[model samples]
Target: MERFYRRDFINTLSGVRNAHLLGTLSYKKVPNLGLFNSVTHIGATPPHLGFIMRPLTVPRQTYHNIKAQGHFTLNQVTLGTYQQAHQASAKYEVDEPEFEAVGLTPYFSETHRAPYVAESPIQIGLELAEEHHIKANGALFIVGKVVEIRLQSHLIADDGHIRMDAAQAVGVAGLDHYYRPEPIAQLPYPRPGQEDKILKPKNN
Candidate 1:
């Protein structure tokens, strides 16, 4: 059976990709960045990632940053830096540096030519590859090609999986609530009658 919810169902979903995207302002000059909870990994083979821009919204700092640099870093938002992430999202004057506002440090990227939040534990370098507009809701859909991902050495699990439990990254339910994640399964999304195998690790 198919299921459906109000178009605003996203506002009710409990877990979402809330990240701190860092980039420099092209039009305004000073540092421009923001916290975006709408990011996702699109494809793994060629490493495509995606994020959305809510429609009718005036141009955003991070949007201008991407336009200026053609690159941005998706900093894994953490509890320690959630405050900074939230602070960075404020609509500050285009010329004002959000990092300066929060006293956070910016690290220059060697790969993508964009800056990332130095305080973040992990980050992904990305370059814009595709963009489309969501017609019904008027949202802007963007796909970024992953250039590189920086991660701490120990976050790797014994099976070589990203030990997200150790990463301490935080997610948002909507606009206000934030929480750490718990893993239920890794891969091989299961079908009915596959429950027993689903619970077992194929890698073993």
Candidate 2:
């Protein structure tokens, strides 16, 4: 396979991925935002999240800021902010903050030094916990502990699952294609000798 084609094929093979806007702040207080599809839930006991970052062959402001500042924000991309979120991935000058260039509002709170996207429906503030550098590729595996979460009260369910459909959260396929997911059904926990039943979809 050709180089570009191989890259695209491997990226999309994992199916749809949650699109997130990662916000960080430089030591100089310059807010930076970047679009990422690699965010993954690591654990719940201590509330940890991990994301894969590209190899730092060049200056990666997000990585630099997170390492230097020790905090970052993970904001869910919504339909309204998907375009701007994608645009945030562009390479900009070290002094030029992506938040200003992409036209997204940068929000800050007393609890965190990093900025969050004001347009994002679900915002998570995290404190840098650990970072692992892959030997084969210089990619960094960043782990952060959740410090704060902000979202609409109605978007969460009693079971703790966020109603993503109601939030209009967007997902990415391959690199550029975006999609909105619909909830199909919610099923009960599996038990021994339990009969299989078709669960009804939630009313959105």
Candidate 3:
């Protein structure tokens, strides 16, 4: 294991998806949006996920969109969509619509009116459930119940895992470093005497 400490890595390690953060504004009010480095999964049994959005200290678009529409989509961005993902993160003026500015397509979630990235490989429509205020950084942690989920057919795996590497999943480190998939250890991750099989497989 490598050991070095310069600063507590500025990562949004909170459990959530690291996808392109998608949000919807209004009927006549287009949403002011940006991408997030912090996102993750929360539950599987009940099927839920959330994003840690900043508070209303300076008028948060995601928070306001959630409050007004009660809906938002967390879109997972990957290498295939890297250009738009980085382009959308620019802090645009309040009056401009990010989708319009960046030329990204928006899809109305069937489960709710909130919009999602049409070009994204995976998108989840969420209804706001809870807002946790983390005052230290003025970040409002958002919890949403999963009402809908959309994904490209090729990304789903038979083992019930989203082949993240093949999906080209990206991760953010510190303030601005972005990371794509990297090769790690191979599968069959068990050592001798560490097997948990109580019964042997019988060829019938």
TM-score of each: 0.82, 0.93, 0.78
Candidate number that wins on TM-score, 1 or 3: 1
User: What residue runs in model 2 are displaced by over 4 Å at the alpha carbon?
Assistant: 195-204
Query: Which candidate achieves the best TM-score against the true structure?
Result: 2
Which pairs of residues collide in model 3? Answer: 16-39, 16-40, 16-41, 17-39, 17-40, 20-77
**How many pairs of residues collide in each model?**
0, 0, 6
Q: Best by lDDT, which number?
A: 2
lDDT of 1: 0.75
- Model 1, span 32-133: residue lDDT tens: 677778787688999998888778468676776686668877888887888778877777876686787987777876655777778888888888888899
Q: List the lowest-lDDT window of 10 residues for candidate 1.
A: 1-10
lDDT of each: 0.75, 0.91, 0.72
Please estimate how well model 3 matches the true structure, expressed as its whole-model Cα lDDT. 0.72
Q: Residue 75 in model 2: shift from native, Å?
A: 0.4
